[model samples]
Target: MILHKDFASVVGVRRIGKTSLVRVSFNDLKDNIIPLSINLGRLNGKNYSVEDFSRLFLEGVTDLIKNYTFVVKLPE
Candidate 1:
């Protein structure tokens, strides 16, 4: 949980379920928290800059917010 201590890099050997763990955590919190998780491993050959990553992340979040009306709805 202390991700801010050492720059927060989740690194390990192959097939170690790092991505799965993230996915599970995301799923568990998706209802109360808006999150976007991207697997850079899938884009192994594709070159992407920080700007590209930010754009992708924002685009995903925007799409999620659009569909999850609770994100925009207010309770009285």
Candidate 2:
């Protein structure tokens, strides 16, 4: 999925290793891809607006850049 640039969702009951499977897959492909994992569960049970979602999304992106800053080359 990473190689082909396809999106995937791992859906299952709680504690069923969905997160683990994705983590391991991304770890193995770390050198070949940038992985961004955002948990929207934080918004659950609350009145989340677009701004809230944007904040979380940007936070995820910021974290991804921090983690791969040395690994990926940026254009000038």
lDDT of 2 by residue, 1-76 (tens): 4356677877777777887899999888746777788877767547889988898899999999888777657899
Q: What is the lDDT of candidate 2?
A: 0.80
lDDT of each: 0.64, 0.80
Backbone clashes in candidate 2 total 0
For candidate 1, what is the TM-score?
0.41
Clashing pairs in 2: none
Model 2 poorest 10 in a row by lDDT: 1-10
Considering every candidate listed, which one attains the maximal lDDT?
A: 2
**Model 1: per-residue Cα lDDT over 1-76, one tens digit each:** 4333323356678799987887677688644554455555544356867877777677777777676665446788
TM-score of each: 0.41, 0.68
